[model samples]
Target: MGKLRWNILGIRGNPLATRPGMVKIQEKNVMLRKCWKTLLIGILFTLTLLIAGCWDRKEIENRGYVLGVGIDHVVSSGPKGLYDLDKTPQAAGQRKYKLTIEMPKFNKQEASKEVNKGQNHLIWSGEGESMFAITRMISTKTYFSPFFEDIQILVFSEAVAREGVGDILDFFLRDAEMRRLTRVFVTPGRAEDILKAKLQVEEVNSTFIGKLTANTDKAPYFAGKAELGQIAQALRSNHSFIVPIIVTEDKEVRLLKGAIFNKDHKMVGEMNELEILGGKILRQTLKQGIVVAPNPADPQHTVAFEIYEKKMNIDTSVQDDQILFTVKVILIGNLGENMVHEQDAVDPVFTKAVEKEIAAEVTRSIKAAFSKQQQLKADVTELGDLVHRQHPDYWKNVQDRWDEEVFPMAQLNVDVKIQIRRPVITH
Candidate 1:
């Protein structure tokens, strides 16, 4: 019937019991936590609206995928290569460029309902003072917006290439949608005709041409793949480069030679198929090519050696203001054909003789290509790069004149060694 005893600190028997104003403080803390939870939920809900979906996304079906582009200079307005311009503000001799683009024709029907049958691409063209302007003008004619991200090839007419590709490529280099890996080519005639030419292997002519460039390893005649980025880099560095050449005849297009360009990005000349074969071997490396040499036994007949693997090294040195480049090439392949009926493949002497003949033939081809380069005064083989890397101090003195003067006067020595592994045919 008595009250419990308390400690000196005003604590009861239960030490954990709440004191007088603690109830109000606990109530205030609970209220604060609830407010914070509600505020956090509101912030999360607002953030969800901001990131609900892609704001700048475009539907794939509505985008026109541009696969190929061609450029040609408008020379005349009369009967041939007629260009229709209502009014002109420029001078008399000022030139305009024509642009052509190839895009896939979207097939919406089922397989059984297909009508066009083997027609899967369409070509659209326009003309303007600049490529960017031309591209914008072309967009207006298309139902879907032209997308350049998938562009596979760019072809320029000989006239346009001769005038200088720097101006035309400026737009492609600067555009965010354009890809740097797009292949580049030069055609002797109208580039639009190349795009319009029919192809039996591929549905799209642009794709076929692009694939053809990839066969440089198999075919020595090919100029190899010249990419947009590589050309841009060459132009930026003021170095000479080469673009593959193509010709269209009887509704068929054929990749033939290489259009050589000088330091100014102007087409100076072209490299023939044989010259390309040698250049590829000397400058880079060739995977396949035929080497024809006069047979030792029979002077009239010839022997063919097929190149399967090749490796090369080019070194440069400067002495008394004279530059000398030494190129060493090692080629290993099989005996493709032997017209000499007397020579036997089983004999080591015969194989050695054949190897020597093949080496001489390779040397001659390379020298011929080097001679052509000297004649044009264009260093398409990237010889300047060798000097810059090997002899930097000397390169600085003649860097400006490397392509025009120094490279032409430079002496080149090509040393080739050949090995015939598998002789398929004897005699």
Candidate 2:
């Protein structure tokens, strides 16, 4: 108050009161702005560097796409037959199974083209004591990596399937790239034959085989086609698994029969066309068929009914010491053809009679399958599972002799009900 202080600029209080502190603050602000610009530039440079690298890129031309897998058993000379003393017989004989992978020839130009041309399918075989060894050998021989993600079919030799499928499927189940949706089949002879068979129609044998099994729905007797996942589940469950069997006849692949497996993965028996339909009914997987009914009046002519849908249910019960199994099959179909005397008028009376005959055919087919089971000593219908489920206490008593004792004596009762939804139209 004695002497009033004035700023050098003369507008307000002294400007130099905290001059050093103000200079320090301005310098800190400028340094912070420069540091932020430098940090932003470093981040942009890192992103640009990553965009130029190809560390995870895989070109299609460098991959060998697998379409099908075939496995067979190699006959070895040994007292125990491919068995070693150190390992269990099943594990010891595992080396007998030969693995084959089918792949199309690699062409960079063809691979890049929208349509494939002039590329033939090639099959490579590898021998090992197990699937893992075979796969390792394949990788060693080929420069490109083998990919199993595209595999659509798996074929097994009769010998391998008859011996056991547990070991054959072990590698497929464990592999990360193998697909679960692949279809599985059993060849009548060596599995290598199926993979090596040259088709006149298709470019590749695997693609031809895949189409043959996929279109089997058009056939009268075939049931639900077997898939890898389905077979795996059946093998693990109490019920046995069934796979379509193919044989080469006159240089053409044909559906010869169906191979049936027991719980132990051994091929117990085979079923023909009629037997397959009957077995499908027992398995509750039958879908469609054509039922031919003989004319009562003409006796020489027959009427055909085209089945559109079918549902089957199996029930089993145990009373005292005897076991009873009942099958209920319902069919919905349309009257397709009347080859009896060329009648122009439709008759409802004859239609009812045809329904009765259709039911009889189903009953007869099922009985034939039962007779085959008795001859083979195989419970292909999973009667064992029903017995175990309905009467666990009794099943425990006969678990050892269930196959030999209760299965042979098992009684079957079949009931078939058919309904005609449409009548044949006369032009």
Candidate 3:
């Protein structure tokens, strides 16, 4: 085969025979080779730049991830409910809460070698006039940046909650990294105890507390789950607020009662298990439970029904210058255990009796909660808001005297309708 000769220009002359033409062709070939090499180098350089580089990257071990925070009122010997400017220069004459932050410590090498050692967490604490200030102090003390994104629980001391929770929560809500879904808990005596409580089952104390609050939905006495967003909204709402109360018994954190708050953020009263269950039912947040219905024919034998579904509708009416609130709750479930003397499982007579029993139970529970509300004079359920929403004109007339005259005089009527889907087991 014959080699093809290069033609730089159509000059119609033999480049090999002419010196100037040959020199021009050689220069053009050298330029073309140099251009190809330059293009290849540019492509390689661009690929090298595209590779990942360490730009603001942080290793997991370097992060101080906070799991829980506890706030407690500290007594400074400076002044009465005030801080001495000479002793503490940060803020003059301002009382503050001692804040504790719990975080997990992960030694990279040890963690990589052993998984159990990495699970061990540590807690750091600081004191300042305010929660925000204390958190700032913590950041100054720790070399690593404290991250609040991983916080799962927030424990507030009884004294702090009794004084006021609005201010303490203001910091959490305003912080960009703080999660609104984190669980907020009210400790019985001191929040530090709850934070320091050893994890009996779960690996992390925060995880255990998180699971405890999450499992409240399955309990009979507990109502809807309390999250950071819900509490913040309740604080800003027109009505009162209620929080899930936690108590330490036998060194275990237990959900015992609910803290009832008046118009102010301070807790005015509390509800026990029975009262909390009744209040939850009135609020229509009860998820599941077993209701016992005594047999009319046989006093000893009682029928049990497993509540699968429940819906509550509250209606208010102004009659004769008096506000009357009627609550209608419909429940649909299956009969779990029946000890009554009846062979027919789907008998119409048995169904009617069950409905009556359910109605009586609902009425009793509602009355019980109302009785407590009257006793404490605390509108925990925000029934006043309901009246205001339904009858705005009437509320305006009695807005000032609603808490004193109207609320005390308000009457509640509860009606329940229950339908049984099936028996515990098919006959």
For candidate 1, which ten residues in a row score worst on lDDT?
Answer: 1-10
TM-score of 1: 0.82
Per-residue alpha-carbon lDDT of model 1 for 220-304, expressed as tens digits?
7678889999998998898888889989876567788999998888999999887887788666757676777887667598888
Judge candidate 3 at residue 296 and give its lDDT: 45
Error of 1 at 33 (Å): 7.0
Backbone collision tally, model 2: 1
Clashes of each: 0, 1, 3
Best-to-worst ranking by TM-score: 1, 2, 3
The residue-level lDDT of candidate 1 at 196 comes to 74
> What's the C-alpha lDDT at position 359 in model 3?
66
> Which ten-residue region of model 2 has the weakest summed lDDT?
2-11
lDDT of each: 0.81, 0.74, 0.74
Q: Is candidate 1 or candidate 3 better by lDDT?
A: 1
Q: Against the true structure, whose TM-score is highest?
A: 1
Give model 1's clash tally: 0
